[model samples]
Target: MSTSAPEDFAQALAQRLGGQSVRQLAAVSGWGRTTVSDIRAGRHIPSEAQLRDLLMSVGADESEIASWQERRSAIITPPAA
Candidate 1:
């Protein structure tokens, strides 16, 4: 499996947001503006619920959402020693 950094996934999501402001996306996603901003800035990795909300709000397809979720899992999962 090809692995992508969480920052790259975050950047893709930000680009998918198009012209929408972070504040606007937060409103649409029912999350705090700071949370959305942090995600966009790659300072925070979104929880599954947050990811779902973001994908839905931005009308992301199932494939895109799945790809992001997989990337997220890879980032958070501990590596074998």
Candidate 2:
């Protein structure tokens, strides 16, 4: 992983889904080469529900998103670190 923060990750996703060259989109989004390649190859951007469902279907943990959401909320509400 590139150690990009969660906020950057969110912004990258937003911009990639926004208007831009698909190739440039990967660089801007800070995604791994493989991830970008796979996405471009048509791995659909899964919705939160779909992702959660998929995680459960595959017997993987899905609690991390909740933890991330909590951390994001704290960052939003608290004084800057």
Candidate 3:
């Protein structure tokens, strides 16, 4: 398997959540079809607000959501101890 990573959480989530063929994001706050689609396609990046909402939509708790938000830019590098 290739070690190369995918673009971002949005892409990964979309894949895990299934169906890139659709353009609807019903329960995710402030996120309609276009925003989700753009993020998944890597055509655009999501804002902090959008990121948090995405996590909540996917059944993630506040802690997980915070972790995802706090480390979005840090995903490219490991954090120091």
**Which model scores highest in lDDT?**
1
Candidate ordering by lDDT (highest first): 1, 3, 2
lDDT of 3 by residue, 1-81 (tens): 543333655556566445424344544455777777676676665677777776666677887777776656566456688
Candidates 1 and 2 compared: the better one by TM-score is 1
Q: In model 1, how large is the Cα lDDT of residue 46?
A: 92
RMSD in Å for all candidates: 3.7, 11.5, 4.0
Candidate ranking (TM-score, best to worst): 1, 3, 2
lDDT of 2: 0.45
In model 1, what are the clashing residue pairs, if there are any? none
lDDT of each: 0.84, 0.45, 0.62
Model 1, 17: alpha-carbon shift in Å? Answer: 2.3
Query: What lDDT tens digits, residue by residue, belong to model 2 across residues 12-79?
Result: 43443545444654455455555554443444443344334323433345575555345445544656
Instruction: List where candidate 3 sits over 4 angstroms from the true fold.
Output: 1-10, 16-27, 75-81
Pull out the clashing pairs in model 3. none
Off by over 4 Å in 2: 1-42, 64-81
